[model samples]
Target chain A: EDQVTQSPEALRLQEGESSSLNCSYTVSGLRGLFWYRQDPGKGPEFLFTLYSAGEEKEKERLKATLTKKESFLHITAPKPEDSATYLCAVQDSSSSNTGKLIFGQGTTLQVKP
Target chain B: DAGITQSPRHKVTETGTPVTLRCHQTENHRYMYWYRQDPGHGLRLIHYSYGVKDTDKGEVSDGYSVSRSKTEDFLLTLESATSSQTSVYFCATQPGVAKNIQYFGAGTRLSVL
Candidate 1:
């Protein structure tokens, strides 16, 4: 079974603070690791996709890095607008045809200005 | 935010009633998905469609059913609503299996009272 686990369920950070969210996973074979941000009352927004270990992707103040068994979403100098629930999901190679995703519990980030 | 829209942005209904949520996409994507979000659970796949008339269940598909009669629309129905079914539902789309980037709709908030 494919599973994703995210740690530090909730975090409160001051504006411009830098931190990283952790996502650990166990899968038969990894096809992709995804990062998403979701705000209250809204669906998730895609951020980045890392296809292999040692791969990294970034968007503005957010950066995502993937390893064989874990992934990290690093936020650099975060702002109030960056406050949202960060989600981590993985798609195993076995699901290449179906494109199914197994998601984590997510980390709620609050950036205080 | 990707030309996808979910109807009945918010709904409230009594338990035991039947309910259906509609997801419409203008991108003409070949794959569509339905997922639910709740506290302590990031997002769990309910069902997904690979193409018109081709649908399959996901990990948490027990109480949900889905249909895709057209490429641009996917509908998820709850046969019998229960209090535990109250959640924020999201619809997502992907261009194809090789490209796993998924774009999500605004989401629908359902409350089964």
Candidate 2:
């Protein structure tokens, strides 16, 4: 079975702190890897999509990088506004262009002052 | 936001009751998906539709069904709600151009008593 695992299920950082969240996967073929940020009582927001190994993308302070077997979301100088649950999802090769995603449990980041 | 809206942002119901969650989109995306998010468990795919009258089951489709009779509307129904079904359900749409990005609805929070 295809699976995605996110590490450091919960991360607590001081305001302005920087850290990285990890997403590792084992699947037949990796079509894409995506990152999302979800706040409490809301849905996951689109972040970045990495299509292949060595691919990377950024938005504000969040940057995502991918490898053959895993992806990383790096948070730099996170502020309170960045406190949210970060989710990682991978598109399986079994799916066509219609697009389907397999997700991770998500890492909850709490940026405190 | 992609003009996606999920009805009954919050719901409380009893087990064995029938419940329907609706996802409405204005962008006319070709792909729509439903997922359940739970603590310790990642967001699991429940169902998806590629177009009107075209639907398929995801990894976790038990006790649930979906319909997409129009490009803008997707419905998810629970034949008989179970306590285990209480969760935050999210509806997402894939834009034609984004290979990995899926915009999401606000989500529906359901509680089964």
Candidate 3:
């Protein structure tokens, strides 16, 4: 069975603090890994997609790195605006060309000013 | 913020009642999907449409149905709403150019009493 798990269900960080959120997965064949940021009363916004181990992507203060069994979303000097629920999802090769995603219980981060 | 729009941003209905949520996108994306989000559980796919009149069941499709009669609109229906179906429902669209990237609309919050 393909499953995705995210640790540290909730985290409180001071403004400018750096931390990392983890996403671990067990899939038949890894196709893609995705990261999203969701704010209260709103939908999730796409962050990055990592396709292979050792792949990394960055945007401003956020950086995502992938491994064989897990991925990490590292927030560097996160601001209060960065406070949101971070979601991690995976797509397995077995899912026919339809592009179905299996998501993990998100990690909620609060960057207090 | 994608061009997707989900109608009935909030709804409250009784169990056994029929309910329908509408998703409209201006992006003309070929793929549309419905997902439900809940606490302690990640978003789960309910149904998806690959093209006009082409729809398929997803991991959590039971008790739900979907229709894509035109290129821009997709509708999700609950034949008989149940308390267990109360959730925040999100509609996402995948542009053909970015097969793995899905853009979401502000979710609809549904409550079944």
Give me the overall lDDT of model 3. 0.95
lDDT of 3 by residue, A1-113 (tens): 99999989999999999999999999999989999999999999999999999999999999999999999999999999999999999988876478789999999999999
User: By TM-score, is 2 or 3 better?
Assistant: 3
Clash pairs for candidate 1: none
Question: What C-alpha root-mean-square deviation, in Å, does candidate 3 show against the real structure?
Answer: 1.1
TM-score of 2: 0.95
lDDT of 1 by residue, A1-113 (tens): 78999988999999998999999999999999999898888888899999899999989999999899999999999999999999999998998888899999999999999
Cα lDDT of model 3 by residue, B28-76, tens digit:
8998999999998889999999899999999999999999999899999
Q: Please tell me the TM-score of chain A for candidate 2.
A: 0.96
Give fnat, all candidates.
Answer: 0.81, 0.79, 0.79
What are the per-residue Cα lDDT tens digits for candidate 1 across B1-113? Answer: 57999999999999999999999999988899999988887799999999999999998998899999999999999999999999999999999987888899999999999
> Which candidate, 1 or 3, has the higher DockQ?
1
Q: Write the per-residue lDDT of candidate 2 for residues B61-101, one digit (tens) a residue.
A: 99999999999999999999999999999999987645547
| 10 residues in a row with least lDDT, candidate 1 chain A | A36-45
lDDT of model 1, residue B72: 96
- DockQ of model 3, rounded to 2 decimals: 0.74
